[model samples]
Target chain A: MNNELLAVRSVSKAFGGVQANQEISLTIPSGKIIGLIGPNGSGKTTLFNSIVGYHPVDQGSVRFQGKEITKMLVPQIARLGLLRTFQQTRIFSGLSCIGNMQISAPVVRSGLKSLFTKFPIDDMEDIEDILAFVGLHSKRHLLAGQLSFGQQKLLEFAMALIAEPKLLLLDEPTAGINPTLINGLIDRLRVANQELGITLFIIEHNMRVIMNIADHIYCLAHGQLLAEGPPDKIQNNQTVIDAYLGAN
Target chain B: MRAWHYLIILLLAVSAPFILPDYRTQLAFLWLMVILALSWDIMGGQMGYNSFGNIIFFGIGMYVCAVFQRDSGLEYFQGLLLGMGLGGLAAVIIALIIGNALLGMRGHYFAIGTLGLSVVAGELAGGWDYIGAGSGLTPPLYPGEISERNVFFYFLFFVWAGITFVSLWWVYRGRFGLAINAIRDNEDKAEAMGIYTTRYKVSAWTLSALFLGVIGGGVGNLIGFIDPKDVAFSGATFGVWMILMAILGGKGSLWGPVIGAIIFHVTQELFWTLFLGWQRVALGLLIVLIVVFFPEGILGWLRQRYPHRMRDANNSTEKNKLNK
Candidate 1:
């Protein structure tokens, strides 16, 4: 219990008759990579959505950095240094990739002065370095819509990095990317955790990626927590394997 | 694209009344259209709110200014300034109140809610007797019928149009512009990235109200008389025209609405003069055509044809040239 960065205590959510998540509890320690995996309808996405305040939970609490955040909106959570990315990659299609990078930085103070001034030079430099790190420096000038789907995911990831979230909740970062790019992306995620010190709570579908990357893994099934342990233990856990087998 | 290109346009705009004195009134109206379209774009185009009720601000501005002039025993110019100032202030206050309520409704709900606001406002203004009811009220009569009044109003409108364009242009290049564009693209994502969207939307609408209210006061005095349905709350005319001009010019670009206003005004004038009674039909047809055929507008087409124009200059020019 080395100072949990995020604490989800007995959280539950329901959509009419559908119980999307029930009595789900988890803790993510600071400076660690955590994985959440479940079959398509097992409430994995719902859990991620709840933590980021895309919507309210029917019951329970979410505390980030020991501060209560259950009542917060998405932007408020982001301002508090918690951020999440969409599975579909919600980059602004009409803006150039650099524009995407530029807009992603949290505004310190948006005032009448914001109307008259250019974005700070420091932000520009930061965006360039982030873009380069994400392997998008050459394509930064291209409109985000023009980028390939894989590249757009990278762009979205880079944007989240620029926001400088203390804890990041990524929804399926390798959903549709080619296998060849998977290793590179996983390498980048580690670098983000190790170098940037971002606590990553990733919802991953790819077995190889999650098993190799996550320090601790949580298995969700039928809207409840099935198992939680080290990645190797989760990988070897008979119950976790049987749940995936039954779902398949 | 270049400073000189804009400078030349500015010079031409300033000299338009002198160059064509006969069309001074029409030019003044055109400048007003530029203001309306550009200000409307602050919400409709930039933030993707598509506020059909924006004309309410214009109408409020007109009534407030006219009421001030009629009731207050101040000098003409002094009264005009005070009336306009108060009018803008009133519009901003109303916007803040209604904006918080109205902004919660997304997409078509927001659009329809705003549309109802303008309609209800017109009806309310029509029934109220203190503001002269349906028959309308005239501005304080000018002494001795000043000869250069058209030129005076023309230059005034030009100056206002210049202010609207320059002010918005500054915003469109900065952080606020990016915030609105992000809202337009995907509001949820913008908020998730840490932009407080409701505050931004309300603020943008308030800014639009301030400008519209001032323009309303100016236009009210320029016209000298106002009818609740026909002039002040002419939602069908002014409201529709604001959205149409922004769309025709290219919705999200800085210079798009201005160019659209010029083209739309010139063509609309020609249609009004040529077709007379059939101008409304022509307007309907032109809107249909623009919506169907040129939905992207001239700027969008230009952006597509010349991609380099839309990219930030931070990208090396050498790379740009190579891509070209």
Candidate 2:
């Protein structure tokens, strides 16, 4: 039994003549934090989209726990315990912090019963717990739109965590966030991975954040995997340094 | 709180026909408007998808009942049931096609698609002669004298009450409401959180259409006359009015649009009777004023004034708190 939770095998995607992803293959283990870093237009978000079923792979296979899910819709893939966040925080602006979490909470499909009944299952406690974990318990009633950008990012994390996903794909979790909040978010991510044992595949431009938390790293440039190794090894790799640091 | 609220509404509904004047049969008309507004709110307000073609369901309801009575001599209630079935069937098809296409199109395009559908439906109705073409079929009057109009009025009241209660029950307590609200707030996020947004949107359309259809049939039977102009114009006006009420009452709050429909219809009736030809202009101006100053609507204003009382965390919580 392979302990791999997700495997993207030789996946290729092209838009018109532009190849967005080129034969990218990666395996995410059940309890690991893997960092994905790349220069702009390196297909980091594209790969994330493909894994979460936002974008269809032109030629490849995506397996989740040994089942091929390449053709699954985004919601179907999400229901199967693989979830992804957007590059921009996708918190429900109209919903409260807790309401956002509740929307993502897993409930059995009860058709009309789900539509017409407000059953108070143990979900309320689950919402409160997730809020506390994300340090948003105090702001549970606040509209998500009213939260600061950093707070919204935290809310987004809490929303994802409420689903108790087996594999979490986080796109630029630290991007546009202040350094102070970034550290707190990183801590939460660490806790989510370590304590909850949720596998995290993150895309981040912040090398410091990535190197600090990632158990392993994959670097991409121009839709191709440039390097893959432990953080120290990736830090010294010529391709990663040249592709990422050269531009900066 | 919810139980008490419904109890009060039920008491009022049960006593309305006795306390209110007979000439105010128009009040039943207003109740019909409330049902229509609530139906629109479920799809547009709660689901966050603006549908201009909602009138099609209303028109289908009206025509189905009208044609059934004219061709088969079906009783008013039987015609109403047929209309509802037709509306649901039409809605399931339209929702599957339009809902799927519109779900992927954001904002303006979605609105335009519905607008196009409404136009096409109206044109089709106008061209069909067996269904009365430009002229509409009329139902047989209540099988009694003019003095018995109040009896029919009471019947309409119960029908309206039943619909309003059912809609409120489903929308406030059901999983459908949760799914629809989730889709409304952030569709992409909802999808990524395991919501089938397209399916829910289509289901909302189907449900809303079913209600609108039955109400349309009831309204047709109430008037005992149907014409293309009445069906098309009234349907279109009600569609617009539904949006206004949803905005005025605050969308996503189940009772908001109902209150809006009542207030708006009552005010319009008073104004139209008193001001005559100037009534429409006055109503138009009022809509503008309401949108400009109190964009959240009356319920929204009330909620704002008393935030703690209406803290559902889904909608109006922020607006209500801000108003205070």
Candidate 3:
């Protein structure tokens, strides 16, 4: 019953006879690590997309910090301190790693002045800090495309972190990373939540990552929530086993 | 280079016509190309919108100037301003209509949509007599022809400098530049980060059009006569030339288009004087070779070879060197 940082109430979305998400209700309280787990096509991504305004929900409402943001644009939601990352790591390939981070920082001015003057005060230090946090400070000057797959994943993480969002939605952070990198990413997420007090709603399929990092877990099967509990109970639940683990 | 570097370059440019020979007129044309290329770079290159209809604004400016001069007997400078205003208005309207429809399309489709719009604009101009069907119109000569030429050349040089500097500055320092670059890099990621991709894209189109309009007016006044074929066909060539210059110079680099324009136009003039009809084939070959071998263009190639030399030192000390 702690104040919910993000409230998704009875949200539903559909596309041409296919219901991607239906009647999904979830609340993420401030400073908690919540996991969203599901098989492929279980509407985990669709739901995340809806919350972040990537895809409009056909029904229900999304309220962040007591503001009804259903009609807001994606950037507006992000400015309100809610941010999401793609499942496939997306970084500016042409830009250096630091350049990618710098461009994502918000702009303060419009017109001629904004073009001529470089406001150095805002997020330069934060970019360095995030790069160091993600172990990418050493590679800060490298073109993002030059990074290895694991490093690209880290860069994406760093980019998301630079925004300093109140709510961070990570989509499959460990999808293609090696086991060592997975541990590193999970450790960073822990630090982000515990040390920085950033709320996290992560969509992950890796059971080890979910079990190790998630405070609470929601499991979906074929676009419906099959189980929800703390990691321990969710791991032991028969419905989760039959729907997810049994098939695997 | 720092801001001082730009100031020095502008000063040198302003002083050039005084010392340079009759070739200043040719240099003025080169400056025009640079302005057009830089304007095109804003929307097509930096924003990755891939528009091929850039000539639409230029043509609109030409036609409007023609109409204003012929029908209203407006002064040459006044006609240019009127033309620019009309062109900008047309660009805003067309950009909203076409940009909204085609901005969502990726790659070739987007290019084709812009090309289609250019063609439609060309056809519309060809059918309108107010500007001139296909025959075109001529502006009465302003008195003091020699002094006027020098004045006009210098005027264009300053305008060129102003437009190029402003365009580059806008792309480099502002939120709009950041947003445009984000969209170019990854649209979905940019949106998720709270950048409005559509609005930024359309705005880029509008800004680019404004510059194109101004340049078009300048060119129309410089020539003293305008025709639909000149407006449409030459305008289209201007669009293509802008893209070529942008790609050749370094699409994302602020100084790239300027350098590209100078090199491209100078070479073009050289070829036209020497090879005449074969210049087109040679130019085509050059473009193909550049696109194939040096995808990032000359500045890109230079950056690869001398990475540290191109680094913007004041922006970030931890500048990552781009590998060839």
lDDT of 3 by residue, A91-159 (tens): 888677877887676553234344334546546677788899899998887888899988898888888
Pairs in steric clash, model 3: A75-B194, A141-B320
Give the 10-residue window scoring lowest on summed lDDT in candidate 3 chain B.
B315-324
DockQ each: 0.67, 0.63, 0.49
What's candidate 2's DockQ score?
A: 0.63
Candidate 3 residue B214 Cα shift, in angstroms, is 1.1
Clashing pairs in model 1, backbone N/Cα/C closer than 3 A: none
Off by over 4 Å in 2: A16-18, A108-113, B1-11, B73-104, B232-235, B305-324
True contacts kept of 3: 0.60
How high is the CA lDDT of each candidate model? 0.88, 0.78, 0.77
Q: Write the per-residue lDDT of candidate 3 for residues B1-324, one digit (tens) a residue.
A: 657987898787777777675767776787778777888888777888777887777777666555666676677667656766676576667667767777878667778777776667767777876666767767556556775576675666567557666756745554566667777878888878766677777777777776766566566766777766655446447768989998888786677888888889988888899889999998898899889988988888877778787555323323322221
Docking class of 1: medium
**For candidate 1, what is the TM-score?**
0.95
The prediction achieving the highest DockQ against the true structure is 1
Which candidate model has the greater TM-score, 1 or 3?
A: 1
